[model samples]
Target: MSETNDTGTAAPAPVSNWNVPNALTTLRIVMVPFYGWALLVDGGDSVAWRCVAWFIFGVAMITDKVDGDIARKRNLITNFGKIADPIADKAITGMAFIGLAIIIDTWWMWAITVVVLVREWTVTLLRLSILKRVVVPAAQSGKVKTAAQAVGLGLLTLPLLEVDGWLDVPGEVVYGFALVILGIAVVLTITSGYEFFREVWRQRHEIREKSPERRK
Candidate 1:
């Protein structure tokens, strides 16, 4: 993990997984089960529990952003962070999708959850598997997808439209907005996934074509 500095002297210190950023990532992963439990309490009907779940989801999302920023800023990136960070992100959102599908019991919810999760995890696993071999940069579609997914899922994780009270009309409006954003996120997921695989294949193929043996 150590890398040589200028002049080909001794190597710089290796970045450790035991750092603040990775700690936050680990904390986010640990929050996933609690968030799910709170979300599912009373079949996702309890206002207090849903609020708790939303708070936890928000914290997890914030930590996701923070951990990446801190890691890059402090040069604390590690294999653990590379693997666990994505897993943590997917776990929270994946649980959100699954939990919402169960509570809503809508055909579309179930369908989108299946499609999106399959695409997400497949792309994630592929990226991780080729981390050191093929370098596929993040696409704009992927960034948009993450933001839309986070906002949509965060809004939906609340008891907004599902609970009846003073917030009913506004809640419905927000819920509708969330659905629209979630729909866009789903489309972006598929498109970005395709772009990712295509780029990975292109990079690997180019590497092979330029190799000494292949040239010979």
Candidate 2:
């Protein structure tokens, strides 16, 4: 936004980046290391510690949603928020994928983690790289992907496989359900990432095609 000066030229007014949404984003970023620590404590085997990790993760994920909502509703969006928000998101989720894979110690789990993490990080980095060059709005499948990842990973953060005897079956059942959701999230992740990249390419190509300098 700008205001006219005495000479009738517009003078830009600087908006402060310090705001509630940014505060939440910062809090989320700060929580990542602690969340990772909690998840890895006792090799992610202790039921109590795992519960603690889940609580932290749940709080972090909630803040992720709340901060974005606050930013959009209050018009508190900032360059800092744009950068920190995605980093926080990937850090937390990445830790979950990596930590869980380590704890599970299965080739299949590791494969899933590797595939998802690669896609997540690649998409996140490309998004930030093109932050100014293009406005790539999130599609419906992308939104669903985010929600599925959150819920699936949050469920898996619990000590699902550690409970013994009477609770073992129930835990495995829940873990299976979480796995199903995670599988869906993985599919959505790949598809949405492709869509995002395709859209970016199309927009860039369009811009180049319309350039009069290029035509001449």
lDDT of all predictions, in order shown?
Answer: 0.92, 0.89
Query: Candidate 1 — which residues are off by over 4 angstroms?
Result: 1-8
> Model 2, stretches more than 4 Å misplaced?
1-13
Write candidate 2's Cα lDDT for 1-216 as tens digits: 578899999876654688988898889888888888888888888898899999999999999999999898977888898888999999989989998898888998899889888988888898888556778898999999999999999999999998999999999999999999999998999999889889989988888898999899
User: TM-scores of the models, in the given order?
Assistant: 0.94, 0.92
Lowest lDDT 10-residue stretch of candidate 2:
10-19
Residue-pair clashes per candidate: 0, 0
- The TM-score of candidate 1 is 0.94
- Write out the backbone clash pairs for model 2: none
